[model samples]
Each structure stands twice: as structure tokens, then as C-alpha cells.
Target chain A: MKARSFRVLTSLLATLTALGAAAQEEGVLDSAVVRNRLYRPAGHPELSLSVGLPVQTHLTAHYFFDVGLAYNLFDTLAVEARAGYAASRHTGLARSISESFLDRQDKKITDELEDLWQMNFHGVAGVRWAPVYGKLSLVSDIPAHFQAYLWAGGGVGSFKRKSVIQCSHVVDRTAGVCDDRTSLDDRGTAREDFWVHETRVAPVVSGALGFRFFILDKHGVKLEVRDWIFRDSYRVNLLRDDWEAGRETGEKAPSPGLTHLVQFDLGYTFSF
Target chain B: MRTFPRLALLFTALPALALAQVSSGEQPVPAPGPESAIPPEPVSASPQPEPPRAPRERPPPVTPAIQHAPVRAIEASAPAPDAPVAMPTPAPPPASADDTPDLSSEGPRTTDASQQRLVNGAPLYDPNVNVHIVQKKRFADEGHHEVVLYPAVVQLNGKYTNHVGTALHYVYHLQENFGVQLAGQYNWYSDESHFNLELIDKVREQAQAASSLLLQWGVQAGVEVTPLYGKFAFLNNSLAQFSVVLSGGAGLGATRHLIRPAVANEVDGQTFQVPARYGDTGTKFLGSVGGGFRLQFGESYSIRLEVRDLLYTARVDKVDGCSLSDFEAMETARAGNQPFSDLKLSGGCKVEKFDGVDPKTKKNYREDIILGRDLVAEPSSDVLNNVSFYAGFSILF
Candidate 1:
């Protein structure tokens, strides 16, 4: 397998080299025209639209769409505002594994794990810097502009936490009776009766590194690796009376600390 | 006895006759000839004469063996070229009057003294020679001056109120490796308790107006060091340039803690009120360290991406709740450079810009502002510890 992959890579490199040679011989990449047509002059504003998929997420798969507006403050600096909607879905496997482990440890868990939840929307304002710029000769005479940039900022996010009771009854079999009369199955006929618990908004911090290939002066494609960090807390719906009584007792629920959601996005941007 | 003797004699005689016949068949005697009597001249020179030919009316069909006989006969009959034989030489083609003189036929000629001197003089230019022409050096001896401005939203730690702000940075490069920078940022605080409705209602019940934390603007002056600068050849012989810049600076900023007076609410025989407030507005000294990469597009424009940590002392007097006198005392102590108990860590990109000048107007083009200031206020403390990242465009003149 390794040898095959190496062979494929070598073949690709050879093809690129051949194409570059042909392009150079033809003089198709006129430097003068490229200089005039490929770069955005100073002090121009740009707008971009992007869609991204979370390559690595804590417990779910997330996909998002973003619209960004940026203003060039200087030759190397820009301020930007980005707003986007992100949707999350549970992989189901993670929940199943967790439930299975819990079931083995304590047989009281008779129900499956709940589906993962996510934030539906977020807003961010940050600065972007194109710190490195260079040209790559992928095709002989034609050069592609390559740029690497990084950005970070803080924003607000609206997230909903939905969970269903994992067990219908957690009773002592020796007593032949269930102790917690208020358990989901003891009172409710359906699972949806005690499914959703709460919805809350939290602060989100994010950072990203973007590599862009400028095919033209005003148009380019960008690949970005981004991470969003935030705090998340939710009810597990495991215990019975203690869970309900803890709220009145001013006891804090168990929290999952900070969660990091990493995503990769490929999109295009047009600069004016 | 006489019969036996006769049989034995016959058998002996028969054996002798058979032996004699075998000898005669094996060796046929040569016919006596006058040629043989002449005594063969030195054996090396004597050729065995061809066997007496048998004349027949029709020639035998030519076989492979007969076909090769003529070649051997011709080789034997041909005379050697150097055997004292004479041959006529062929006449050369008639020379034409227009024929050019052959230089190879001319004998070597000695060079004249002047001619030798001329030959030794400076060589003349030849178009066929591979001459390397050096291109004008690029990115050499250029001025390094740039300015950038950006706006960003900051979250203090992960739980503190969010601040929206803008920052301006100025950099002047003394050499390729070093530069001085001045940067300033202004931020206004916003209410974040709304993220938790329960917290908002509880705070609202205690204070008719929503409580909020406020952070004023700050400025910093620092030195920037660019330790590395490099270029990469992109597609089509295009060059892209970049640099790594590091910086450290110190500055001062202020923060305000505010709360509104309100009536208390009792529910389920328990009193629910907003948490007591800490001391109000005060100023603190701050320090920042950061590094970034700058990618230059052309002579006038570039993009910068940076990460920085802003550090400052936070003074929160938990014992006294929202007391003006206590806040003043803390301010006095801060002015006296008293040691602070809390340290805040905050950094991220505050701004990134890409500027382009309009060709027709020859002026910097501007875009409509898309982000508006957030005015909501919520409960806040004097602590600010956060990290930030920024991207922006810069102009170099």
C-alpha cells in the first residue's frame, strides 16, 4: 500500500513538471499581464462566502456556512466580520459506546444514549493577516499565487441541548419494586415526554489558518483549518430524585468543561 | 591320414589367399608415369596435378560443390599486387578555373609582430557565446514603513463579558531585521448575561437596570523585531515575499464595574437577589507580547496575521461592594505601583486589513462598515485574561 501511494505521488509530480515545461515553452504566463491582473491594490474591501465541514469534532459532525466582510487597514492588515450558521449531528456510535460502557458498569441504563446537540448560529469579528505570499509553478508559464493567513476572535453562539432519559426504570430487583416512582417510564408513556432539557447561548472563541490559491487577481480558492472552543454543560438524565432535588438545593450540575470543535473548509473568495 | 593332411593344407591356403586379397584392395598401386619419374620438384612447390579428366558428352549438373570450385580456382590464379607487376594510374578530373585554393595545402606561416599583438588584445564580443546577464536585484534597499487598523471582538477568559474594539498599529523598519511599533486599541463592554436568561432575570430583579462591565481604550508603544524574511518563487517566475515579526510592549487601560439598585424578590420562601457587586472603575497597567507573519503582495500592500497575549493587573475588592471610596483607594494604590493579586492574559487578532488604492481617484478606497458596536451591558469584573488572533491589511509607503 505504501509503495502504491508513493508511486501515485511520483506520477502526479511528473505530470505537473511536464505541464509546467510545456507552459514555459509556450510563454503563456506573461509576467506583465499577471502583475497587472492578479493582485488587489491597497485599501480595497473584500467579501467572501465559505462552507466548511468539521473534520474533527468532540462528539458530532458539524458543517457550517459563513459570509465574511473585510476591510483592508494597511497593506498587511485587515479587519473582518464573519457570521455563519453551523449545524451538528450525532455520529450515534459515540453515544452507543458510552451507553454500552455505562450499561456494563451499572445495568440500570436500559435506554440508548441521546443524540448530540450543537449551536445553530454564531457571529465573529476578528483580524486577518496574510503573513506569507509566494508563487508556485504548477503549470509551466502560469504561476499561482499562494498565501497563508491566520485569524482569531471571540463571538456569541446559540446552542440547544436536547437529551432523552436513558433508562425507563432503575429499580432494585431484590425488592421487586422500583424505588423512583417519577422515573420516565413510571409516569410517561413515550420517550419524548422527557426528552429536551434546555437551550442556552454561550461565548465562543475561534482561530483558523487558511491557505489560499489565487487563480486570478480577484478570485481565489481557500482551504482553512479552524477550531472553535467553548464551554458546554448538559444534564445526563441518569439519576432520578437526586437530579430533580439538586436544582432546588442550589447544587451545580456536572459540566464537560471546554469543548474544541475543529473543522476544514474549502471555499472561494472574490476581492474587489 | 592322407585325407586329413589334405584338408589342413586347403584351410591354410584359403586363409593366405583371403589376406592377400584384402591387402590389394586397401592399397591401389600408382601407375608408372614419366611425370613421376621426373622426381617431384621440391614438395612445397609441386602441385598435385588434376586427376586425369574423364571426358563425357554431357557436363554434370552444377552442384554446390562444383559452384565453389571456380572461386578457389580464381583465387589461386590471381597474381599478387606487389609481385613486381606494373599498372596504369587513372587520370584525375580536369580542374576548373573557378576552383578555390585549399588552405590545407599552404605551408605554416610565421605571424608578423603587429598581427601577434593584435591577436593578444582584448577579445571581441561573440553573439554565440553563452553570456549571463544579471537581472536588477529585486527587494533590495527598500523602505520599510507600514500602518494597519482593525476591529475585533474580545472575550475575557471564557466566561467574562465580551468587548468589541478596534486597534491601530504603526510599524517603521530601521533595517531588514528590526523595527519600532506603536499600537492602540479601544474597546467597549457589552452585556452577556442574556446568554443565560435565568442569570439575566435574577440580575434584573436585584438591579432594575442591567449590570455591566466596561473596558475603555488603551494604547501601547513597543519595538518590533523581524528576525526572518524570505521569498519563494511561485508559478510563472513570480516572487512572493514574507517576514516574521515579533513584538513586546506595555500600556495602560481602564475598567468599570457598574450595577443598578433594585428591589429584592422572594420565591418559595427563599430570597433571590443578584450577586453583590465588586468595586467600580479603575485603571491598570498592561503588557503585551506577540508574533506574526506578514505576506507582501506588492510594493504598497500586505497582509498580516498575528497572535498576542495582553497581560494586566486586575483589582477586585470583594469585601466592599460597589463602593466609590474603596474604588478610589484601589486606584490610588494602583497609581503607587502596588503589587496586584490577579493577572489577566488576553490576546488575539484585533484587526486585519487589505487596502487598495483606486486607480481613477488615486486615493485609498474605503468600504462600508459592516460591524456595529454592541451596546448591551452585563455584570463585569476587573479581571481580563484572554487570548486573541488577528488578521489585517497594511499599507507601506
Candidate 2:
């Protein structure tokens, strides 16, 4: 074993020595870098569409579909405006909690849960800063060029919240049913629900890190991880009896904190 | 077998060579080296019989600047008069007519040498011998060893639980694009997330014990493959090489559970804040699959960003080495204020762990016996997936 180690060490030293010699023999290293960038998007106008899926679902899930318009002022910078609607739904865990919480009458008073707001329509204007540009050899002959960028923006969005704990008109309390359904076991037939609902317009902020890979002329593909952040507002210290009798009950929480919805976005762009 | 150490040496030394070139920025242009400047030995006067020459390809037509250039001293690295040279495939035209240089034009050299961009001490004005956007790989990883340290591995998809930790990994490259790895990680902070606490607080509902089980530390042996590599420039100033790596492994990991959350305790009319308590829940089989990018700096160092999913089977039937039956006995002993030493219990049960009082907080360990029993009442089981983000740096040698 010692002899093998010695031989290995000797071979490594010899290999490194040969590499140094070869580097010098080549005169100079290949230093001619990105000066000859084959594609630059400066002064170009573009249209793009993107779809975002939730990275992780907890109480809710959101799928966002958006369309965007952008103008590149330089190869490294651009201004873009995006507008979209998000399709949202409650998760299985949330539904399970709602179904069970209705039967637990022992807890006479409790606070409403947080992070129940769902976004519907939204628009934002953002700046994209692409500081990294380079080329990738896909195979022996094909090459792919790409840019890494960061985007940040803020705008107003329409949001709505439906309380799972509050059911003003209970259709069937023993079976834990609050909706207008024809059968007790089948919830699919529900036409309307008695849960308390509220709607508002609030300011939202978004940020992302993404890569844009240019294809043939005038086209590109993008992949990104984006986070939509908004402040959470909910009620606390509610009287269960008051809410069950179709009456307003709780006061707003002093500090409701913030909610973040993280998504993975895939997009396509067409330059005009 | 002989190829193993050669690959190790290749992976180790290649990064160092790349670093040496990057750090040699002081000289924008190296002085003409002695080897390339030496002319070939006189062909007319040879000491031996003439040998059959290998066939070679014709060189491309040179532009005026290259034909009458003053930098003939640096031509040593160029191919001999009758040698084959590989020319990179030229890039396609840009989407719009912007500042992109037209490589197709064979017109007079417009840019002066001084105005030319200097990369790795070579001017970009010379395309045939120097400028290459997607050049051949300058480093090889075969037969090399690398050690990586991740100061922060944060759980990205935490719904019931969250984990933050530091990890260390070692890899031996058996081939240029494939390697074997041994990895170990220790999570300093692992707990049921606030979302889980909110469910318990606002809705009186909580995740089962197994669903919120925490991983303390893990070790695994696996294989890694780098299928693709490329280079890019940062805002036209700096250049770096990167590879896409995917890896998978299976091993063992220590698990635990939060027995109790922090609460205010009253001791002799003085209230003290007691910290949360955790109970050891034994080890479980661990498996992971991950993918990420490794951006090489010079030759020896690199930055890695990856996402990994760690999966483990969690069955909360025991805690602190005490099984359900042993906990039942301990709970009865605690209720009756009887000595636990007389009870018939499993050999692995560590009874002393649940029979003492905390020295500072004046909290009795016996009070937790009931909570531990509640966890294993029905024996909840789950396969927990801990997906996390790993950001770290590595050194190859």
C-alpha cells in the first residue's frame, strides 16, 4: 500500500509538471472572452407570456397566468409590465381542518386563521437587471446563449378571503355541513356556502431570479423562482356563538405579519 | 484500477491550473515564451533518414493585420506549416442589427491592437488562435478529490416542519463526468414550523407526531454525474465555467421530536421561562436525490447551488429509547410517586431520562411522561420529505 501511494504521488507530480509545460508551450491562455457577443437585445421591444405553479402547497394553492410587455434599453437592462389572473383553491389539509373544526363546539371562542387571502387579478411594472451573459455548448456543435437576471416590482392586486371557521347558517351541524347540498355525504352537489367572505385591494410586492435562454432569432425561453409577498390581515378573539348566528364577532389582530407565496415560473418571449 | 489515481490527480490539478491563469492578470500580454519562438530544426541537414510525414490541412486565409502583423514572436503555439487546426463553429447572426461585430466580413482590420479587449492576456482581435466563446474545456475532473462545506442548508418546502443546518461533503472523481461522494450533515435548528403551531393554536388541530419528526444528522454515500458544462461572462467583464451536477444516495439519519414547547414556569412565586424540550426518536433510513450548478472560479475553488429532497420513514412508537409499554409503566409510576427502579421495563428504556427535574427551570421531567405516551397511542406513521436548498463552496485537490 505504501509503495502504491508513493507511485501515485510521483505520477501526480509528473502530470502537473507536464501540464505547466504545456500551458507555457501554448504561448498564452485562451483569453479572448465575451467581447464578441453574437446576440444583444438592446433597443428591442418584446411580448411574453408566463405560467407559475406553486412550489409548495399548504392551506392553499395558486396557479398564475400572466402576459407581459417589455422594452430592452440595453443588453443588460430592461423595463417590463405584467398583468395576470391567478386560479386558486383550498388544499386538502385546509378542507380537512374546516370539516373537523365545525364539530368541535367545546372551543367556545377562538381566533381566525391567518394567510387565507387569495389573489385574483394583479398588475405590476418591474425592472430586470441581467448582469451575467454567456454561451453553453449543448453538444459537440450546437451552442446555447443565456442571461441570468433579477427582477423586482410592486403593484395593487384584488384579493378575497373566506373564513372556514365562520358559518352563519348551518344546514347540518351534526354532519358538519354548512353548504346548500342535496345529500349529506356528497359535497360535490353544494351550490352555495354560508362561510363569511370579504374582499379588498391591497399592495403586493414580487421578486424573482431567473435565466433567459435565447433560441433562434426573435425567440427566447425563461425559467425562474418567484415570490409574491403581501401583508396578512385577520381577526382574533372571536365569539363562536356570535359568528354562528350570522353576526360580526372579532376585532382585527394587532400584528397579522406577512404571507409569502412562492412559485416556479416558466415563460416564453417573442421580440418584435 | 490504475486509471483511478490518474483521475484523482486530474480533478485536483486542473482547477489549480485554471486558477493560475485567472490570477495571472498582471500581465495583459505575456512576453513571447522561449519555446514557441524557436524555429524548427533545419530540414536540409538532418542526422537521421527522412521519415514519412503525416498529412495536414491547409490553413485559413489570413487577414491583412494577421499577414503583416508585428506579433510573430507569439506564433509558437500556432500549428506548424503542415498541421491540422480545429476551428470553432461561428455563431449565427443577432436578432436585430445592433453592436454585434460581423465575423463574416473580410475587410481591413478596423480596431487597433490597443483598443482590443484583453482576456487571459490575449487580445480578442485575433479569432483564429485566441477568441473562442464556447472553447474546449480547460480543466478535467477525473481522478481528483473535492471537499465542500455548506454553511447554510435551509428547508425550502417546509409545511409542517423546518430545518436549517450545515453540511460537509467529499467526492472522488472516477471519471471526467462521474464521481462517488460521501456526505454528512448536521441540522442545528430543526422543529415544527410556526404554521404547525398556528394550526394547533387557532384551529385546535396539529400534525401527527410522525409528520413533524425532525432530522438531527445524516450520513450517506452516493454517486454524482455532471452531464453538461459551459462558460459565460459576467457583464462582459469576467468569465467562469460551470457544470450541471445530479446526485443520489441512501443512508441513515438520527431523528427526534419536540416533546414540549417553551412555557413560563412558576417556582416559589418567581416565574422563569423554560426552553423547549426534544426527545430522541431513534434513527431512520434516509434517501436523497438532488441537482444543482457548480460554478468553477479558477482551478481549485467553486460555488455550488443545489436543491435536494431528503426522504425518511417516520414511525413515532418510541422516544428516548423507551417503547409504548415502558412509557405506560413510567407514567403509572409518576402518577403514584413510586420508585421507577422497581418497575419491569425494557432493557433499552432509559428511565432516568424521565425521572429527574431540570436544575435551572425547576421543571420536572416526569411531567412529560403523559405527552410522550400521547404520541404513540395509535402509532402514527409517515414518510417525511425534507426538501432544502444548499449553497456552499468547494475546494478540489
Candidate 3:
């Protein structure tokens, strides 16, 4: 199953890269070519970065990261990906549920995310598109590219929530311990599980403004601004129903809402 | 023992507050001028000062019909009371229909006006000096509109009340009373309280978060009126005011979700056997409530905070398809030709009369049903959490 999934992922990436190469071949006036011919090619790929708090509690959200990518598509569009490494912990009600289930003294349930998916490792891949790819010139009446458009795409986003809950005696209402207590399946027993995501399904939509620049003529750079609306399997309920009384994990979120991202994309789209 | 410290703190603070208010230049005197040399009464919980009146050119002498009114005097002396201590004047005979004074209430001698009066207390018309900012928040009331792209059967999670399910809600409030302009609020919730707790017993902790679309069709309207308008605060120029409002309405809702009850059994002692069942269903409930806001946000759009407990319920999937009364016949039929399993019929799941609690029995039984159903609420749908989420806009006239 893993191998088959990997094959599909590889083919998908290759196909996307081919589309980019093919689109560039159309001599669609390479955004890089236009920049080199008209504006001074910039030295660095115009990138936007941000390192801020991951609005949660108890856990120190004091972390920072940058966003941008390395790729070229067009003056209005570019295929790039964003990566950030920050210290964040899973928390909130979701984590709280998992903690409750994990109490060995109470539920005694052991099966958590580690048992369900990541006993060893997990991986992530993404595709970022910066529509309205360009730079901004000061003192120019022309409002930076009259930038606006619709963006719909997907990426991986997942957070963790860890909570500790209290578990006292568990007895059926109006009944004694009729059911035997020992050797219940770990999944069915009282336990806590860490809520983690193997892959976050994110589709994107956006509008942006900026200008394009090229360095050495072959490299296309853009400082684009985008108001991105990410449609992920947005979970409304961070907690799930099936979660055992004390043990629960993973995102039992129902899809409903969307996240907003005001990202600045700066990357060099190699212009052949 | 722990609560004792808190009580002491409050006791100490109350008197200190009165002293502070008295020391402050402004006197929240129940009566104005030297002749009103009365001791300050202890209505000090409220720091609001009575607004100083603009000197009126020699007014006529005091009316013989009413003077030395102890109640008014007490009300005047105690600038701030634990509760409302209005004037002793026989309210100008309710001149209007809307503002008619409800005297049946407040008829008791709560206090005497004469006993309450401060030396510097001055007569003032507008006492609510605090900034009585009446903000109006308006929510776009477009009927419940949403599209569910998910195509999985959502099971019912034993969480939220049966008040909602997979749905949409559009809320609008005219924060004066219980008057809300609802473009629409439709909710679908079923009472699954009797949901096969049996199957759950057999199954392990493995759970699934069902999606749901809950729509609540209700209207809310309330107004925040500064009861004692123009009553000034001593610390800051901002005035102090108490706003009261009453709001209520009714609406129906549609709820739909999946009920995949799982059961677990001992399988050869090594592993447990479990099976997941598919049951998609919906129920409707009528919800209403009256709540007061401690503080309505200040202006056009301020944070409107409130503590309200709304009551609503939904029905769950019924396997018996029979009411409790039907059980009488089923029990008798089972003794002869009918198999016990065959007798299992789904009567619309209803909370038994005994479901709430049995006072005589002093215990909860099957008849005692828990109100409301649960929500996952439907597959791919996330209405709100069990604790739930409710937001709205409020406008006051």
C-alpha cells in the first residue's frame, strides 16, 4: 500500500513539473524574460517570511518561520511551496480528550496515534501556487498590478492538541460491574491518544498584488502578496464522538470552516 | 473553609468602597443642599454618583403634601446600593401604557427615604452620567444556506443535546428585548438518548466524528436601556447605567446525521468481535429562551457577551418503531409465538417519562430519559461543538 501511494505521489509531482516546463515552452513571454528586459533583475528571490505565535495556550507559541518558494510559472501565477519549522505542541480540547483516554490508571487504553498511524514515521509533500506573482514599485500611481484573482489548491496542515482529563470510577448506570473488567481491547479500554494528522488536505484560494524581477535573466523572482483562503478538511469539532471516554486521539474534526492566510510569496522561477 | 477568605475579602472591600466614594469630591447625596444634612446610607456597592443639578432659580417652597420623605431620603443618601433603590415619589401615575409602573411589585417598605441623605447631595434630573453608549450589532439574516459536499453517513456521537445537527444558522438581534430578525434558523436533531448503548458496550474506544448540519430558525430582540440615565460615575466622567431587556421567540430546525452504533463481544477470548451499523436519521426541535446581557457592547459593533442557557431537543433513530405503550403488547406476544428480537420495534425514540429522574424512586431509570440527542453530527459536517458555538449581532434603540 505504501509503495503504491508513493508511486501515485511521484507521478503527480512529475506531471505538475512537466506542466510548468511545457507552459514555459509556449514562450508565453517568460515572466523572467520580461523582468530582465524591463526591470533590473534582483539578486535574491523575493520571498516573504513570518514567525509568530500559533494562537494556542499553556504551550509557548513563541516561534517564527518564513514562507516562500523556489519555482517559476508566470507573472500572475507561480507554482511554489511553503515550509516552516517552528516548535508547536498539539493542544486545546482535542488534546485534552486524548489525555483523558491515555490515563493508564483510569481507562487503561494504550492505542493512540502512534499505534494507529505513526508507530515509526510519517512524511509530507505540498504544492503552493502564488497567483499574482510580481514586485512593487514605489511612487507609482498604478496600484501594484491591480492584483486580484481566485486561487484553489491543496497543501498539508495539521496541529496537535493535548489535554489531561480526570477519570474516576466507570460504572454502568444503575448496574453493577456486570461486564468483566479485564483484558478489554486496548482501543476499547480506557486510554489516551495523541491527536496528530498524517496528512492535512488543504485546497487554496487567493487574490494578490506584487511585481516580478529576474536575476541573471535566467532566474525569475517575485515579491507577491496574497490573501489566501485555505479550504482544508476544516474540522469544526476538534473532538470526536467515537473517542473512548478517557482515550482519544487524532483530529475528529468535521469539515466546515476555512483558514485565512495573508502570505507574501517570494521565489525564483527558473526561466529557461 | 476556602470560601471563607473570599467572603472576608468582599466584606472588607464593601465598606472601604463606600469610604472611598464619600472621600471623593462628589457626594452621591440622596438630597441636595444644607437643609438635607443627613447621614450617608450604605448603598455603596455602586460607585455611580448622582449627577449635580443645574441650579434652578428660586423654586417654589417644598410641597406640604410630601416632605421629609424617609424612603426618598434613604435612596438619596445611599448613592449606590446592592440593588436598585429608586426614588420614593409615588411614580407620576403611569402616564403611558408602555412605561406603566408595576407597583404590585416593589410595594414593600424596602427602605425609608428620610433615613437616606448626604449633606452635599444635590438634586439632579439626569444621573446616568456615565457614557451610555448603546451599540447596535447587526447580523446578516439570510436564511440558513449551505452546501454539503461530503457524501458519508455521519453517526451520532453521544455529545451535544438533540437541539441541532448538520445545518446552517443566520442570526440577527435588535438587542432591546427578545426581538431578533431571523432570515432563518432551521435545525435537525433527533433524540438518540436511547441510542443502543448496548452496541457501544461491545465496541472499544475507537470513535469517529460524524458530520452534521444543524439549522436554528429563531429570532432574538432585546434593548439595553440605562435604567437611571445620566447617573454619573465619580472615578471617571464615564457614567454608570443598568440596562434591562426581555427577548423571546420560537423556531423549528431540521437535523440529519448517521448512527453507526458499534458492538463488541468476546471472540475466542483472544480478540473481540465488533460490527459497525449504518443508520442515517433526523429530528426537529423547537427552541426558545430569555436571557439578560450584563453589558451590551458599547457601540455600533462591540463585543456582546451573554450567559444564556437555551433549551432544545431532537429525536434519535428508533428500532422498535413503537412507543412505550406498544411494549405492553410486545411483552405479552413474546410469551407465545413472537421471538424477543422480532419484538424489537423502533418507536420514534422518546425519552421515557422517568428519563429525567424519579423523585419517588430516588434513582434514574430507563423511564427517566436524558433530554436531547448527540451530534457527530453527520459525516463530513461540523455544526458546532457539544459545548457548542453561538455568535450574533445586537442593536439597541
Candidate 4:
């Protein structure tokens, strides 16, 4: 009777052992399935839309809109192409002086001061490097992925601005007669005013630092600080105060020099 | 002696312990207490085959409990063979599984092929293919013809007035180095108030009054040589084309010297007007040399700035003394074949200079015959040197 009891006990133990083994195997398979779902791969294309506030030093400031297309050459490297419209307004000092000149009774000087400040349209192609990538989990359940990147490029900008000149009454409004007072040269029939408009094309070098936060897998928001270095040769009365002093002494005014611009932007990005 | 027996009992019970473990499972279990030890028996010591049970029979009530107890013990003791290894968790999948792309299968995402490659952290080449590259036009291309028209203000150096004029030029380029051009210009100068009325009246009385300051027109045929051609970036970005052309030519010119009455006189209480007269009108030979630069704005349009120097000689009729009524004396002196005399003054007396005796009259003549003491005269002929500049638009075909 005892022998029979022992056999039954052994058999029951064997059955329980098999059940335990089966449960462990099932757990392993579940873990693997979860891992496969979370894997992320490299190499994707990104598209972005950006709106910027561009400030040109001592020149103008305005809003700009840009659309960019970029491709990931590596896990952390990309090439980007951007085109944008830059709309700008004259600086406060520039505007005030322009308004003052425009209010003058002399139509010639007023016309020259009109539209003296303007914006430019530009294009850029650059390479971006994402050297730092990380994640943040401020909330217990939600996590965020982000990257810090820097970029540099070169491009062309089309700039149009008006040129201004100050003249004396004896020199005539057109100033063409200033040199030869004795000669009766026919300065073209007076248009109600006098001013010369000039357009220029400039080469620009640009650089930027940006932070991108991926709110979703393929979408993100970015904040950027960028600068464009270019030369602008639009003549303005930068030395208007000194020039007015010189004018009182019958001296000629000095000419304007070259300047540059900077911009800050917030944007959205989509990756493919 | 007590220890030896206890060890002996322990050894003897080992077989039963092995049998019980094998029946329960592969999991190890704690050994039973010595106080509960049982003697080794044949059924426990020898490996024995047990009878198979019916497949439908139910397991004993202790079976589930015993099976679970060993399993729980083994789990607490050591990990199972198939248990997951402790490792960091991977990132979660995208919001939507359908949105996750297989990057390897996708086509080239970048617009430029070179962007796929990298050097030093930057793209190997610029991805923007639309960058503007300035292309210079070949000079020897066919159909190089151009026409230009300009309205210019011309000032003749040493002349009192500026000439407002229009100029036209037609050029046919045979080669980059040289071309032929035909040019013409017409100018008109208005009268200016530089001299007083009294001085003008004195000049008019001597028949040398100046009316219009300048009136001239001319046409020229020339060959132009382009000695230099170059390009520079405007605002350091845009390409601008420039060429220097040197030109030389000869042409015919017409000039007129007009005289208008300086003052009106009242004769017999009736105001009489002095009719205007043409003092001289002549056509002369002229030569010009010039140079200019052409700045190209587009494929078909350009701006040209030129400076030219013109040389010509003009003839004027000499007037003697201060009278306009010397016609008879001038004719008699000419018919008599006498040397032309310059009236001079000595001690308030009018004197005329005669060189030798008159052959027809057979009379000796004084060499220094005084006509008047304070006579003033103007010269007859002069050379005019003019430099002009023009700016205009040019069209190329």
C-alpha cells in the first residue's frame, strides 16, 4: 500500500513540473515580441516649415518664411535646402530720419528718402550635424526624444534698396549740375522729384544652432538661432547729424557702408 | 558511536530521497529531517518500473499542491533556464505601426545624389541644384549687331554755351577684337547772357556780332577696337559684363555763325528794326577719337558710356576799324591791287600802313600811315576743340 502511495506522489510531481516549464517558455516569447515593436532604425528624410524674425544690423528687421527639405545621410548627419522670403522694415533711427526727410518741403530729398529700406529674398543649402541626441521623461508615462544640431551654408540673396543723396540749392535737385555751374546743361525735364533706385545680388554665408523635440515618431518642433553674413552696399545717411553739420559748413556728406543680418525661428518638422 | 549510527541512517535513506525527487520533478528539494528517517527498503533502493495509469484518471489531491510547492521553491532559489535576461528596454514603436517605414527599401530621399555622401561632417557637395552660375557669352558668336541712340548735353571747351544734342550709333561687329560703326550727332546751343548790351553793339557795329553760341551737326564712320573685356561681381554676387572700346573716325561738319541786331534805333520818330544776318555758314572736315565702356544688363540690352574729342577749324570774316560802312574803300583798295592796310593811331591821328610806292600811280607811299589812334579789331579764323560725353542704352541682335 505504501509503494502504491509513493508512485502516485511521483507521478503528480512530474505533471506539476511540466506545467511550470511551459509557463516560463510562454513568458519568454512575450518579452521578445515587445522588444521587436520598440526597435528604431536609421536613415530618414525630413521636411520642415519655418517662420523667422530676421534682424539686419542697423539696416532693417522683419518676418521671414522658409520651407526646407533635408535628408539624413547618416544617423546624425543631414543635408538641407531652404528657400525663403525676407520681409523687413527700416530700423527705428532709419525710419525716423526717413520720415523727417520725407516731411521736408524739398521734393528731391524726400523722394530719395522714400523706400530707402527694404527686405531681401534668399536661398540656402547646408549640412546639419546632430551631435547630441537624448530623451526626457518628465512625466511618468510620457517620454520625449530630442537632438541638438548645428548647420552652415552659403547662398545668394537678392536685395533692392534706394540710394539717397543730399544736395544744395545752387547744385540743383538732380545734383548733376553741381560741378559745372557756368554751363547750361539740360538736366532731363524735372520729374516732380529726384531719386535713384538700385538693385543688387549678394552672396551670403549662414550658420545656425537648433534644438528639435520629437513629440511623435515622425514629427517634431524646432527652435533655431541663425545668422547670415553678407555685404550690402546701399547708400544711406548714416552720418546725417555730422552731414547736416557739414552742410552748414558747405562740406560734402560721407557715404554708407556694408552691413549684415541675423534671424531667430520656430518651426515644425516631419520625417519620412 | 552515536554519530556513526546517525550517519549510517542518513546514508541508508539517500535512495528513498532520490526516488522521491525524481518523481516530483527535476527541481531540487531540501533533505528530510533525521528524526523522520526511515530504513532503506528494496522498493526504494532498486529502480522499479511502475504500472501505467489510465489516461482519463484524475491526479491525486496532493499532486497540485506538491507540484506548485517545488516550482515556487525553485523559482525563489534560482532562475529558470528560459527566463529573460536583464537588459535595457528598447524605445517604443511609432504612434502608428503603419507609419513606420523600412528605410532600406525606400528610394533616394534627397534631391541631390551627392548629398548621400559625406566628408568631414558636411555634405560632400551642395544639394541645391538651382544655384545661379554666370555664363559668359562668346564674343565671336554670329549676328553681333547693335544700335544705340542718346540725347547728350555737349559742351565745347572754351565756348560759352552747352549744346543739347542727339546721337545715333550703329555698330557691326566682325570679330571680338574689332568692329565698324556709323555715328551722327546734331546739336543746338541757345544764346546766353555773358556779354553786356554795349559790348554786343560794338561787336555788331564791326559786323562781328555773335548770335547763337553754337550750332553744329556731323556724321562719322569709324572702326572700333575692343582692347579689354572683363567681368566683375556686382555686390560681390552677380556677374556684370564690361568692355572697353576705342574708336577713331573722320567726318564732315556744318557750323553757322548767326548775327541778330543788338539794339533797335528810332529814326524819324519811327522805330526801325535791324534785320538779323548770317555772318558765316561753312561745312568743314572734322576728326574724332573716343573711347567708351559698355555695361551689359541682360542678354539683349546694355548701357554704354563714352567720351569723345572732336577737332575742327572754322572761318570768320575779319572786320576792320569800328565802322560797317567801309565797303567802298575796301572794294577800291582791292581793285587797285594795293596791300591791305591795318588802320593804326599815332598822336590821336588816323594812319594806314603802306609798304611801298604804288606802281599804277607812280607815287611813293608812307610805310606807317596812321588811320586812328585807338582802333580795335577781331580775328578772322579760329580752331575749335570739343570734348563730349554720352550715356545711352544699346540693343544687341
RMSD of each: 39.2, 13.6, 25.8, 41.0
In terms of lDDT, the best-performing candidate is 2
The residue ranges of model 2 lying beyond 4 angstroms of the native Cα positions read A1-31, B1-133
- Docking verdict class for candidate 2: incorrect
What is each candidate's DockQ, to 2 decimals? 0.02, 0.18, 0.01, 0.01
DockQ of 2: 0.18
Q: Please provide, for model 2 over B50-75, each residue's C-alpha lDDT reduced to its tens digit, 9 standing for 90 to 100.
A: 11110111123344443333321122
Please give the CA lDDT of all the candidate structures. Answer: 0.42, 0.69, 0.28, 0.43
Query: What TM-score would candidate 3 get against the native?
Result: 0.27
Candidate 1 positional error at B299, Å: 3.6
Locate the minimum summed-lDDT window of 10 residues in model 1 chain A.
A1-10
TM-score of 2: 0.79
Docking class of predicted structure 4 = incorrect
Candidate 4 residue-wise lDDT, B278-304, digit = tens: 232457677889887565433455556
Cα lDDT of model 3 by residue, A162-185, tens digit:
222222233331221112344343
Winner by DockQ:
2
Error of 2 at B92 (Å): 21
Q: Is candidate 1 or candidate 3 better by DockQ?
A: 1
Candidate 1 on A1-272: residue-level lDDT in tens? 11111122222222222222222211121221112112432377778888988653323667888998887674346788889998776555433333333234333212222224576799988987764444443322234555656677889888865442232333433322222444533433323322334677889887777767766456678888666767756444344333323331122336444555666778787777
TM for every model, in the order presented, reads 0.34, 0.79, 0.27, 0.30
Which residue ranges in model 3 land beyond 4 Å of their true spot? A1-44, A51-64, A70-72, A92-106, A113-272, B1-181, B189-217, B220-397
